[model samples]
Target: MDSVLARALIEDPTEDGRLPLFLLFLAFLATFLITRTITRLIRAGKGPFRDRVAGGVHIHHAIPGIVLTIAGAFTSVAVDGSSPGAEIAAVLIGIGASLVLDEFALLLRLQDVYWEREGQLSVQVVSLTIAGLGLMAIGIDPLSDHTLSVGHLVIAINLPFHVAGVLMCVAKGKYSTASVGAFIPPVAWIGAIRLARPHSAWAKRHYSSEKRERAADRAHRFDDRYGRWGLNIEDLVAGKPTASPAVSGQEPSDPKGAA
Candidate 1:
């Protein structure tokens, strides 16, 4: 099986500069699945595994994740790009990313809230990372390919438009749209021209009171239409979200708060 897989990777034309990316994706998926399974089992009190306690302090997995990340980063930087070592480095990085992102909420809030609503952030981050890796593996180069093809004069003329689109999308709180728009100019333009999210920085800074109300309405409608579905999917992939005691009384906040 290993020989066959290796031969397939080597024979594939699109995998030329993508072997590490493929390995990274595989490692991330494997690590995330394994981690989630173990965590769930622990949560259910069905596993022998317990939290690692050192000196009466419970150690989070992210500690080891950080170390692995640093080691993988350094290894990737030090080794030849074309060497087989790069694959090992990619796998290490992927595993590290999975471990760290699995507890992303703890890192963000500086507290243990793995089962809380905030934990959804981990699912979001992991999903985004996976999507990004998938795009790269499929040969999407964002701005690089277009920039390389254009002449200096054309690039000079087009650069500002691209920048403006990206900036506008970001300001309007359209992150995923902005990311895609960076690769496909039209997507950026649409995001830019669309109404800013009501609580977004752009809306606060630039929108009139009336426009802000309209934006809020639109945002509400969008959330009502798709929010539950999105949340369900996140739960399915990353496990159900746990509610934090402090924030339990408050209304459920948007996942990408005021992005």
Candidate 2:
């Protein structure tokens, strides 16, 4: 017999029409964890893995990630949703997306900031992406769940309002909320109604000095209460920055040019 997890994921999915997404979430999460482990080991000079270098250029994993993402996305779009081809495409997309997000900071900076303090952005981005995927896999879609009714129709019709909530949260510098709000309408609505971060565009452009001070106070309090836990989690998942990590002078991984 298969294990309990297998039974839940493959045999008896918790939600209707979400098995493909569940598979994708699992694939993405597993791929990201494994890739981060290898990269961290390479950075610490503790494992067999090393950076990838071409004839003379360094090769980043994002290149192949981009290829796989495009190929899988097109295949997923082309294939029947319930078919095995769609499942394969979903897994490919998940793997490719994880690989790309694992070095998100590097892409934004256009350099190997993978082992620097700025590398934390990669972890943050990957975490948000995973959270969004996990929510979707668990059936937290943006609108109605395919059930047809007046209320469902209204909710679906108000999709633009929900989207605005997501954008509002982003503008207010509530990224964690924005990540959830993108999938769950109520969460975004709440974030949109909350106080904007003091340094955010919304706060800068709209808030009075007194209101900004209050926002800053609240932001700091929240950070002081929760930032340590977040940092610890990030470090645990992606490894902490070293004084002089391998990316300082070394190259990317996958020497056979598979990176």
Candidate 3:
């Protein structure tokens, strides 16, 4: 296995330094899965591990994640080439990223809200990260590679087309689509031409009352159609969200209160 890996890293002419990136993805996935398992077990009160507290203050895993991320980033910058050192640095960075992203809700909300609905943000972010990395692993290079074969003049002429597509997708509030479309132009075109989501700024600015109603209806139908699938995926990845206790007959208030 080591020999095969070494050959792929060193002898493959088509690698283009992607081996380290592939390793990074593997490391990130492993680290994230392990971290999620441990956290879920802790939440269920079934793990040998317990939350770490020092001097009456709980220590969140994000602290170590931040340290590892900084260390790995600096190490990668200082390392000069696509050697084993670079691979190790990539692994460190991946692990750190997984740890940090696992607690993304804490960072975003500035509080501990793991196991709550808001915690689903972490799962979403991780899922997107995994998809992006997987795409890269499969040789999808975003915008930068699109003009590789074209002459400079042709690239210059085509640049506006790509830029317009990207902008249109963004304006429609399809950020994930825009990101993928930046790499693959057809995706961007589709996103650009699609109706804006009801709450998107584009809808607010350009949609007439009737158009807004239509957009709203589309958004509602979409949510109704796919929301359950999304929830299932989130639960599979990050464990099921724990609901807060209701007060009287009303749904529980937001744990963090209204901002």
Candidate 4:
């Protein structure tokens, strides 16, 4: 029973359950094909944010499923007379729960990205908080299951993950593509914090351009208003000012060589 418990801890389902084995193989093939196709699409710049996040979520969750499946299969071989059905049941329950929870967390992270891009502060805060709480709940809930051997491990693993997600939000003020990549873990959060500050280079370039444009516009308007005045000065200097009006009861005098 110690060996059984140890095998159950890993909860790999692929080896023991024939049906799951087939499904696992099928899922692996599908994941491979989909990942390849998505890679090509991404290279072609046809993949959007949703697609990338979705793909990441799928692969991320699938990895654990594959692992558990393999462990399950190995466990079946070890137990000479144990019912594969019971083993598969426990694995499926845990794995299914895990996948749903992981996807939920990813969606929450995606919401942060969305809110960041849209420049919605309230939404960002709310989404990140909710996602964080949801992840915490998932981690805690799994550990409450007495039958699962690795429930404690799952809870332990998620502590760092949750911290990383929170740090990512703190680091990346706005969620750009690069910012999204900074959601990996502690390292990602570190990168994000480093990148989160404003882009001085971009700001400087934009400010300089705006200043130049404003200066040019001001000069243009000044020239438009003062050009006639300047011409009048030139005329006065050249002895060709506009003719003055005649005084009352007096005829106007025309200077020599003046029209």
Query: Quick one: best TM-score, which candidate?
Result: 1
Clashing pairs in 3: none
The digit string of per-residue lDDT tens for model 1 on 1-259 reads 3443354445653356677878888888788889889888888788698778999999888988888888889889988675687888999899998899888878987867677655555655565567556545544434454433234344446557866876686667654455456566677777788898776668788999999899888878876776566456556666775654425455443343221
- Report, for every candidate in turn, its global Cα lDDT versus the true structure: 0.68, 0.69, 0.67, 0.38
Candidate 2 lDDT tens digits, 1-259: 1232243345444346677788889999999889988887887789789889989888898988898889899999898685787888989899999999888879987978787644555665676577667645755454645534454455456667777777686667665555555556788788788888776668788999999899877777777776456445446665766555435554321111000
How much is the lDDT of residue 220 in candidate 1?
Answer: 80
Better of 1 and 4 by lDDT: 1
Clash pairs (backbone) in predicted model 4: 12-68, 12-71, 12-72, 13-68, 13-69, 13-72, 14-69, 15-73, 16-73
On residues 1-259, what C-alpha lDDT tens digit does candidate 3 reach at each position?
3433344445543357777778788888899899999988888899598888999999988888888888888888888654877888888889999899989877887867677655655655665577657545544444455534334345345557766776675556554455456566677677778777665557778999999788767756765766465456446666776676222354442222000
| All-Cα superposition RMSD per candidate | 7.0, 9.0, 8.0, 26.3
lDDT of 1: 0.68
Taking the tens digit of each residue's C-alpha lDDT, what string does model 4 give over 1-259?
Answer: 3553355445544444433333333343344334434534554568572333454553444356557656655665666535655445445434533333323323544532111222122222333433343333222334444555465565566656655654454333322212232233444444434423232222233346665455345434544765355334423222232244223343332111100
Q: Choose 2 or 4, whichever is better by lDDT.
A: 2
- Deviation from native of the Cα of residue 159 in model 1, angstroms: 14
lDDT order, best first, reads: 2, 1, 3, 4
Residue 177, model 4: lDDT of: 16
Model 4: how far residue 229 lies from native, Å = 62
